[model samples]
Target: MKSNFFRGAVALGALALIPATTAALADGEASSYKALDEFMDVFQKVRSDYVEKVDDEKLIKGAIDGMLASLDPHSSFLDARDFQNLRTQTEGSYGGLGLSVTQEDGAVKVIAPTQDTPAWRAGIKAGDYITHLDGQLIYGGTLDEAVDKMRGAPGTQIKLTIVRPGRDKPIDLTLTREIIQLKPVKWEVKNGIGVINIVSFSANTGADVRQAIRSIDKSLGRKPTGYILDLRSNPGGLLDEAVSVSDTFLERGEIVSQRGRNKGDVERYYAKPGDDARGLPVIVLVDAGSASASEIVAGALQDQHRALVMGERSFGKGSVQTMLPLSNTTALKLTTARYYTPSGRSVQEGGIEPDVRVPQLSDPDYKNRPKFRESDLRRHLINEIKTDNAALEEDSKDDPRFAATAEELKKKGIEDFQLDYALKTIARLAAKPGGAVAQAAPVRKPATH
Candidate 1:
């Protein structure tokens, strides 16, 4: 017999459908009555006969994960705990082993340990594959499961067994959890050039950048001739923060745009007049880890000729995710729309390529070390020639001029190639006519530890 009661229950629980389930509906209309009736019968049959008292939350989350996993690696559902962690990342404080872990090649890989955190101090480097945590094998587990195992209260200890490239055996390291406050922005006047390092885009990122710029001005008593916005290894954050950061550098121009399934979803953000830095020669440093909001800022600056991008391609996360609250403290972070640069470029699968490609110079010892290479990973790079060419056609703009090749950059013999290039570029620009004249000011020396 067809279960009419079950059909009514399924109809009431509209939230059970996946994010893309809406697309299954036509013109904003719900599924047909007959389809819902059949779906409910199957759902009840599965629930009633085979399993133990199944958790509705777990089942829902699993369904959500399955749905998102099929779409893209980057898009996934964030439960309450996951959402809290996401919030903590932006606030720059969290209690954990202090390593950024991401899903790579069907397993969790440590991207990099936070500076001065337990993971870094314990000799956990970027590109280490985590095999086990606290003797619990994580080989086939999800990224969320691995993350849950790693995060805990301060002063708590967790053991991580990892496999490195050159090492034959898995190394076990026990680390204590601590409150990690990420330093998003670091600035210094190196060799009479202003160099700013943007580790990530966060809620406070715009304020942080402004503060750094002001501090530089106070020390030098004049604006920098040129500025370097280093976005290397930046995994990106809030979109509003990225827009605000771009606004600081640009006077009057479109920053970025967004497009969705509906034409009404299209929107553009522009820089306000007062916040422009004018014609300061600027360089944006990027790498494979630089993504989303980072890509937005980099793409906008490069397209507008406001900044010269240095380094390899970015992480190419042009999609915008919005959090939809669910009952029982759970939430869904769905990809709501795809973003484009001011020049109408979609960075989705095709990341923003640098105007200048400067690859990292590997030390002899570091070369053989287990480290994550963007190229070595599969999902990191997607051939988006179609998207790139389409966006180029719409914008009708030429590509920016690349300064030097990766080979030339490797020959510099500099410890930090990106910073070195920025300093050199700034110095050259300063020597030009009508450039910023450095004023003699009492340098406030950094305090000794």
Candidate 2:
């Protein structure tokens, strides 16, 4: 029988959505037994002759960890506790500080903080390096270990020391743990337009979005002529949720597809016959922090000419991880396939490029901010094909509108240039004399992952 497939689940730090599959065993060679003999010999020696007696479970778990570690960063062995934690995150609530992070350059790097959570409210930002936890230096530990250190009972507190770019010295912050209930989709009507902020793709994201749209329509007393789907700094969540979100806007076409190692093991997702958005003018906002399921949505809409994707290139993570349950109550999260857009584009090292690249000029550090992407991941999979680098800067002829600094924009009552730009653009197109929607120029065809 085919193994149970895990669609998507939270990654250790935040939205690490990986696909799951039944593991196929490889044929063993004669030397494989010899290697096992060597491993067993070492295991027995460690159990009997170590400086102090070690727990057999610890030794074995460590062995499994090492084995998975050799495969890739996304492939990991989750103990029973970790297995439970993964399930809790998928359900969209858990007791923790609420941050997504990854291992980078031997330090725990924040991917993005879940909005409204303790960490987000505490000012944790993407690209921040978590160097210490609770006065214990966290360097050199696995991402899972660091995440474990951060998880705690609700109402408890934890201390973290962060090293951020452009900061002269390390900063320390104490955060109280809470049950982070991720609502996933939040919407508000702004100036007769609907603004949807997708926090993550949890199990209920699609349903929540539908409800949000209905609420916005009712509250505004009319259907919105335009919608802005903001996906900035969204790490990602359930893959199925991503599909449903894409389907909400698309009438019919391919949404996404995952190709595994086996020649015949390809999974494709498609949109339903109807579009809930009713073909309204839709704009998608993504950024360097957007990843996985986020990229999937942006790529699908962009390819189908259904939405205009704006902002910087996303956090290029196109690989899918499968959660494999082990015999000993432990589980393995392994990257088993590379996902492609409807047009057969891979978002691995090269992320989804926006149709129009817009710089976040209001932030003073925008130019110098360190970009973290799948390429930055230590063991990220290499694209089976190579693609040109996505646009990383404003086109040489800088737009005067974005040359203003944060202080200047604040003076002009513009707090966020990206959102404001998208809103105005949508409004402009809607107000045109012919009432025609303007689509962004198509992005370059992406090379497969």
Maximum-lDDT candidate: 2
What are the lDDT figures for the candidates, one per model?
0.73, 0.84
lDDT of 2 by residue, 126-184 (tens): 89999999899989887778988898799999999999998899999999999988678
Assess candidate 1 and give its lDDT: 0.73
lDDT of 2: 0.84
At residue 306, what lDDT does model 1 achieve? Answer: 74
- TM-score per candidate: 0.75, 0.86
Give the clash count for each candidate: 0, 9
Give residue 65's error in model 2 in angstroms: 1.5
Minimum summed lDDT over a 10-residue window in model 1 is located at 437-446
Local accuracy of candidate 1 as per-residue lDDT tens digits, 1-449 = 36987887787676667545867665345447766677668667767885587766666567678767676556677777786778788775878877888887567897766656798788786678998889988988778788878888999999889888797889999889998777788898876557787877877888888888888878899876678888876778889999989888876688888877697888889887754344677888987668788899998888767778887678667788887877666777777788887766778766888886654543333435643443355543343444443343244343343244446556765556656756776677668885532221222222420
